[model samples]
Target: MFAENKLTEDFGDIRNFLLSEREKTLSEAEWRFRMRGYGYNLKRVDTGYEVARMTTQQVIGTLDL
Candidate 1:
């Protein structure tokens, strides 16, 4: 019975983690859209993605920076 309870708790933790990660990803995507409006080229890469901002000059000076 204790094992079953532990398993349920573990699953709940996982669900929470997934929900938070999804919210974070959505936020990043929204930010990317806003950046694009300002002549910024943004691409979404899903593998261990980290949110960052590039200076306008940096973006203009490089193809991939």
Candidate 2:
């Protein structure tokens, strides 16, 4: 149950990050760099999803406290 909660929270954080970044005027490379810094990789999939799991390990780590 805890893992489920964590996943949900992570998804929310990811979505929020994407929305906020969309408002910025960043180049593709810069945007990917920023997302990587937050433990996410941005990609445009055929399903309309814009996030891709590029690394098995979280580069920026988790935010749990």
Residue pairs whose backbone atoms clash in candidate 2: none
Which sections of candidate 2 miss by over 4 Å? 1-10, 50-65
Candidate 1 clashing pairs, residues 3+ apart or interchain: none
Candidate 2 is scored at a TM of 0.49
lDDT of 1 by residue, 1-65 (tens): 01222433243443343344445555756745644443344454454332232443332211122
Against the hidden true structure, what lDDT does model 2 obtain? 0.52
Which candidate should be chosen as best, given TM-score against the real structure? 2
Q: Which regions in candidate 1 have their CA more than 4 angstroms from the true location?
A: 1-26, 45-65
C-alpha lDDT of residue 4 in model 1: 20
- What lDDT would each prediction earn against the true structure? 0.38, 0.52
Could you tell me the lDDT of residue 31 within candidate 2?
A: 65
lDDT of 2 by residue, 14-55 (tens): 665655665574676776676666556655445444565556
Question: Lowest-scoring 10 consecutive residues by lDDT in candidate 2?
Answer: 56-65
